[model samples]
Structures are given as structure tokens and as C-alpha cells.
Target: MTLYSRVRPLAFKLPAETAHDLGKRTLRAAQSTRPTRAALSYAYGYDHPALEVDLFGETFPNPVGVAAGFDKNAEMTHALAALGFGFVEIGTVTPYPQEGNDRPRLFRLREDRGMINRMGFNGQGMERVKERLEEDGTPGVPLGVNVGKMNSSTADEAIEDYRRVFDRLSPFADYVVVNVSCPNTPEEFDESSPEHLERIFETLAAENDADVPILVKIGPDSPEESILELVDIVRELGVDGIVATNTSTTREGLESPEREEWGGLSGKPIADRSTAVIRAIAEHTDGELPIVGVGGVDSAESAYEKIRAGASLVQLYTGFIYGGPSTAKRINRGLAALLQRDGFSSVEDAVGADLELE
Candidate 1:
């Protein structure tokens, strides 16, 4: 086991968010020197060029990427990239910072291998996050900013909230993700609804002077039909791509004591459901729109399933928690082997290869 694996138990002793912060800080601290960079390159580098993927006008070194909400403030992009993620989407950042929910808001369910978090988009504001990115410079890999509304922003004001963040961070981002499907928010303001989603997208897309690729990050709670409807809207509006799934609210398949916790559910419980949604999009989208498959991806098999189903690229969050620091390398290596075994030359060619099309 690696050092991270050995210390994971101690890390897990803290609240999930605290343990996450500790890990992020550790990564950030380790990345400040040259020796660390060389060591990380040695530990995590994958030499296979066939894992390359070009999506939304960007070329990713591989399909495996780090999802948002892990580095909610864009603090560790360089460090994460050093560890071998092909791309890193940082933050569900808002125009303003908020503390999110109170403590005990995060819970771990080891038995069923899941986590529940009502963190409520708690993060540093866009300005500070952008500063971090500026100081660190963009990661060697493609860097994306995942923008969300401030906690206090009303649904009616959603477009304004998203607009400001997009304008501020767009210049520094290779791409921007408008997050409309965070499950921890209060009810009666479902931003993921067709009406709100359109308004939000139109608002941000209009103000995009950088005209950087803009993506929509949806939640896994969406029913299959709902997913297709959104995909159609995204394509119609010319949204760059869909980041297929945030976290699920349904405890539909989780079997843990903390399953009773009220928050967004991620990790293993979301695997099949998220993958099914991605598959439906592949089938319904007819290979026109691209997909960034998230949710329940902690292994090469799961990541490959998403790729074969239709994802041009894949991202993960909860898996890192369970897989420890070397998780990206492990999965990337496994993906390289799987790609050769499956007779595919590159990740781009693997996209949508398994859809049951007419």
C-alpha cells in the first residue's frame, strides 16, 4: 500500500470534508517544488498516447479526469494534474463564498461504499479561486471551472449569479461548466428544469466573450426521460457538452446506516443508475452531442463502461476518496490495458461504440 493508503484510516477519522481538505492541502504542499514534480511524474505517468481524447475543442491526454467538488476552490489543480488526471474541473464556485451547511453535513457509509454530503456548494468565491489558478498558472492538462450560484442566490436571479461567475473565470479557463443540478439545495427552485436550465445557459453563453467551451453539469437524480430532454435542449442551444451527473438524492440502492443522512449521494450507489443515464443519452443523442460521464466511476471497468456507452471523457470524485491518492494512476493504467485488449486505438474511437442504435 502507498503512504496515502496507509494513512487513509487516520484521515477518515476526521469528517469527510476535513479529511478531504487535509488530502488537498497535502497535495498542494507537495507540488511546490521540483523534486516533487519529478517524483509525481515518475509515480503516475502513463505513456500511452492512445488514451488521448479531443472533446469540445480541447485535447485531453486521457479520458480519465478529476471531477469538480473535490477541489472546490481550484486550490489543487496543478497537484492533481501532477498526479496524472487528463483534465481537472475545479470548483462549483459561486460569485460569492458561503460556509455551506453546518458540520456533520458529510457522512460515510463504508458498508455499502457510499457518501452523503449536504455541503450546499460551500466554496471560496470565483475571484479567489481564479487568483489561485492565476498564481499556479493553468495546469499542464486542460483545466475547467465548474461554476454554480451562491447559496443565497434566488432561482429568479440564477442567470445573474451564473453570468457573473462565467464572465470572471472564463478568461482563465480552457472550459467552463455551469452546474445546475446540485442536490443539496433547498426545494421549489430546481435549476435543472428545462425552463431554468435554458435561461441559465442562455445567460452565460451570451456573456461568454472568451467563448470558451461551456458545459452543463446535471444531477444523477434525473429520470431517463428527463436526461434525454435536457440533452436535446443542450444540443438545440448549442451547449458544448453535458457533464452527465453530479450526485443523486435518491437512496434507491444504498444500504448503509448513513444512507439515512439527508444530502447528495455519490460513490458506488450511483454506478448503474448513472451509467444507464449515460447509455440513454448515447442512444438518444445519436452520437451528436458529447458526454462527460461522472458518478460512481472508481475503476477502469466502470470508466470503460461509460466510455463504451458514449462518454468521450470521464470524471470522478468519490472514487478518489476511496481509491486514495494513486487512484488516477491505477485507473489510467487499467484503462490503457483495457483499450488494447478491446482492440481500440484511442479513447476518441471508443466513444459511443456500444449504443444500441437503429
Candidate 2:
């Protein structure tokens, strides 16, 4: 059995958030020095020519990435890269630090291979993250910054919040994601409203002197029409792309008792739903809009399903927790093999291969 498979039972015993913190500490130490980082690279890194993907003006060594919320403060980016992820996206970072919801907010749905969290954008904030990036430098692979407003911010204040964090951290980002669809945060305003989204895109577009690609993260529970409407709005505003999706509040078909927890649902249960959203967006946009799919990606098959639906890339957090350090290597290797089996030359070629036109 794999080391993480052996240890996960013990790790799973701790509260989900506590276990996550401990895991990050271990990763931080692992990536602390050149030799140690090199050791990890030797052990876990998997590189293949067919896994390369050119997106966001940067070449991703592979299309599998660590989704936002895994490295909220930019800690462990290098470690994650060493573990074989093609890229790492940090934050939902606000202008200032946030305590986020009370303790016991993160729960494991072990039976369902899912998790429920009401983290409420809890993070170390932009300045601390900026300092860490400056100290450690961006990971060897592409880095993305997922920016969010403070939970308490109002509708208009929210725009300024995005502006502040983007201004501070965009220099470190290969691409930036405006997280307007987090279900765990306070509903101070219609965050996904067409007007609000337009304001956000316009504000960021103005602040984007570097012309950093700006994308939006959307949730999966919305009606397909509403979701596509939002997509239409972003496309009209010159937004760079979409992250489909965030997490879901839907508990449909869940067998785990923790399934009732009031927050965003991620991992296995949301997989099909998220992929459907990706396919819908891909088909609607006619494959013109770039999509970074997120929702229950835990294996190569799951990741490949999204890529076929139209995601140029896929990200995971809960999967990493369950799959352990070797997750990315395993997935990427499987992807390369899958591509060849399907007669596709690379990840870019495989994207949207399953789409059917009306």
C-alpha cells in the first residue's frame, strides 16, 4: 500500500481543517531546500511531451493543477509543484486577513469521497501572501491567484476588494480568477448578478495594467440558462476565461451523514454535475472560451472527463488529500496513456473531444 494510503486513516481521524493545516506544514518543510525539493521531484514528478498544454500564455507541464483553497496563503506552492502538479493556484485572498467561519467548519464525507466546508474565505490575506511569494518566488510551473472579497464586504465594496487584492498579487499570477461564486461566503449581495459581474470585470480590466488574464469562478447549482447568461456577460466584457465550477450546495445522491452540512460540497458527488456544466459552457461558447474545470477531480479518468468536456485544465483539493503525494504523477501518467489510446496527441487535442453539436 502507498504511504499516504497507510497514513490517511490516522490523518482522517483529525478534524478536516486540522489535518489540512498539518499536511501543509509538512509540505512547507519538504520544499524548504534544494536537495529536499529535488528528492521529491525525483520520487513523484512525471513529465511527458503529450501532457504539455499551452494556455494563459504559459506552458503547463501538465493540465492537472492544485485548485485554489489548497494553498490559501501561497504556502507549499513549490512543494505541490515538486509533487507533480503542472501548476498551483493560491488564495481566495482578500485585501486583509479573515478568520472565516467558526471551528469544525470543515468536514469529511469519507463514505462519499467528498467534503463540505464553510470556510468563508478564511485566509492570511494579500500582503502576507505577497511577501511569501517574494520570499520563495513563484513555483517552477505556472501560478494562478484566485482573488476574493472579504465576507462582510457589500456589493460595491466587493469590487474594491477585488481591485485591492488583484493590484497586490497579479504580478505573481500567470492568470487571476475572480471568485464571485463561492457558496460558503456571506450573501451580502447578488455576487453572480450580471450587473455585479460586469462591475467586477470592468474594475479588474481597468486595474489590469499588466493585462494579466482574468477569469471567473462560478458555482454548479445555478440553472444552465443562468449559468450561460453569466458566461455571455463575461465574454462580452473581454474576460479571459471561466473556472467551472466552484462548489455546490446540492446534497443530491449523497450517502455520507456529513452530507447535510451547510456549505459548498466538493469532490465525487459533484463530478458529473460539474462536468455537465463544462460541457454546457463549451458547447454554448463553441469552444471559444477557455475553461479551467474544478469540482470533483480525483483521478485521471475524472480529470480526462472534464478535459473532454472542454476544460483546458483541471484542479483538485480533496483529491490531493485522499490520493496523497503521488496523486499528480499517477494522474498525469494515466492522462498521457489515455491520450495515446484515444489517438490524441496532447491534452490540447483532447479538450472538447466528446462534445456533440446541436
Candidate 3:
């Protein structure tokens, strides 16, 4: 059995958030020295020509990435890259730091291979993240910044919040994701409404002097029609791409005792739904817009399925937690085999391969 498989039982004994913090600290230590970083790369990193993908004017070494919230404060990007992820997205970073929800806010749905969290955008804020990036330099692969407003910010204040974070951090981002879809945050205002989204996109677009590619993150529970409406708005404002999707609020088919926890649901249970959303967006946009598919991706087959359904790239957080440090290397290696088996030359060729047929 794998080392993580053996240790997971012990890790699960701790509160989910505590375990996560400890894991990040270990990774941070690992990346502190070149020898350890090199050792990590030698042991876990994998590459294949067929796994390369070009998206948002950047070449991803592979399409497998660590999703946001995993490195919410930008603490472990270099370590994650050493673990073989093609890219790392840091933050659902807000304009200011917030304590977020109460303790015991993160739960492990072990039986269902999922997790529920009401983290509420807890992080060291944009300025700290920017300073971290500036001091450490970007990781070897692409870096994405997922920006969000403070939980207490009103609708009008929210626009400024997003703009401020974007202005400070976009320089370091290969792409920027405007995260209006996080279900764990306060709902004092309709952040996902068409008018609010329009204001956000317009304001960010105006401030985007560097022309960093901007995308939006959507939730899994939104109706298909509403999703399409948001997609339409993104296209109207000339946004760069879409990250489909955020976690689900539904607990329809969960087996774990923690399934009923109050917050966003992520991991295995939401995989199919996320892929369906990707397919819908792909089919609607006629494969013209880029998509970074996320939600419940834990294996190569699952990641490949999203690509076939139209994801230019895919990200995973809970999967990384469960699969351990070798997750990306294993997934990327398996993807190459899957590509050849399916007669696809590369990951780009596989994207949207099933959309037209469906």
C-alpha cells in the first residue's frame, strides 16, 4: 500500500482543517531547500509529450493542476509543482484577511470520498499572497490567482474588492479567476446576478492594463440555463475562460455521516455534475471558449473524461489530499497511456472529443 494510504487513517483522526494545515506546513518545509525539492521532483514528477496543453496563451506542462483552496494563502505552490502538478492556483484571496467560519468547519466524508467546508475565503489577503509570490518567485509551472471579495463586503464594495486584488496579484498570475460561486461565503448580496457579474467583469477589464486572462468560477448547483446566461455574459465582456465548477450544495447521494455538513460539497460525488457543466458550456460555446474543469477529479480517467467533454485543463484539491504527493505524476502518466489508447496525439486533441458526438 502507498504511504499516504497507510497514514490517511491517522490523518483523518484530526479535524479536517487541522490536518490540512499540517500537510501544508510539511510541504512548505520540503520546498524550503533545493535538495528536498529536487528529491521530491525526482520521486514524483512525471512528464510526457502527449500531456502538454496550450491554454490562455500559456503552455501547461500537463493539464493536471491543483485547484484553489488547497493553497489558499499561496503557501505551497513550489512544493505542489515539485509534486508534479502542471500548475497551481492559489487563493480565493480577498482584499483583506478574515477569520472565516468557526472551528470544525471542514469535514471529511470518508465513505463518500468527499469533503464539506465553509471556509468563507479565509486567507492572509491579497497583499500577503503577492508578497509571497514576489519573495519566492513563481513556481515552475503556470500560476493562477482566484480572487474573491471579503465576506462582509456589500455589492458595491465587492467590485472594488475584486479589482484591488486583481490589480495587485494579476502580474503574477498566468490567469485570474473571479470567484463569485463559492457557496461557503456570506450571501448578503446576489453576487452571481447578471448585473453584478457585469459590473465585476467591466471593472476588472478596465483595470486589466496588463491584459491578464480573466475567467469566472461557477457553482455546480446553478440551473443549466443560468449557467449558460453567465457564460453568455462572460463572452459578451470578452473574458478569457471559465472554471466549471465550484463545489455543490446538494447532499443527494452521500453515504458518509458528515454528508449533511453545512457548506460546499466537493470530490467524488460531484464529478459527473462538473463534467456535465463542462460539456454544456463546451457545446453551447461551440468549443470556442476555454474551460478549466474542476470538481471531484481524483484520477486520470476522471480527468480525461473532463477533457473529452471539453476541458482544456482540470484541477483537483480533495483528490490531491486523498491521492497524496504522487497524484499528479500518476495522473499525467496515465493520461498519456489513455491518449494513445484513444488515438489522440495529445491532450489538446482530446479536448471536446466527445462533445460533438454527444
Candidate number with greatest lDDT: 2
Candidate 2, clashing residue pairs? none
lDDT of 3 by residue, 1-358 (tens): 8888898889888999999999999999999999999999999999898998988888999999989999988998999999999999999999898899988899989889999999888899988888899988989999999999999899999999999999999999999999989998889899888899899989998998888999999998989999999899878988889999999999988999998789999999999999999999999999989999999999999999999999999999989878888899889999999999999999999999998743
Total colliding residue pairs, candidate 1? 0
* Winner of 1 and 3 under lDDT: 3
C-alpha TM-score for every candidate: 0.96, 0.99, 0.98
- Could you give candidate 1's per-residue lDDT for residues 1-358 as a string of tens digits? 5887789789888888788777878888878887997788788777579888877677888888999888889887878888889999988888898899988798888877778899998888988987887788878899888888877768876778888888888887888898878888766577767788788878877887667998888777766777788888877887888888888888876677889899888888898888888888888878777789998899999999999999989999889888877888888899989889989988887888899888
- Evaluated against the true structure, the overall lDDT of model 2 is 0.94
**How good is model 3 by TM-score?**
0.98
lDDT of 2 by residue, 202-248 (tens): 88888888899999899999999999999999999898899998989
Clash pairs, model 1 backbone: none
lDDT of each: 0.84, 0.94, 0.92
Note each model's CA RMSD in angstroms. 1.4, 0.8, 1.0
Off by over 4 Å in 1: none
Ranking the candidates on TM-score from highest down gives 2, 3, 1
The weakest ten consecutive residues by lDDT in model 1 span 185-194
Better of 2 and 3 by lDDT: 2
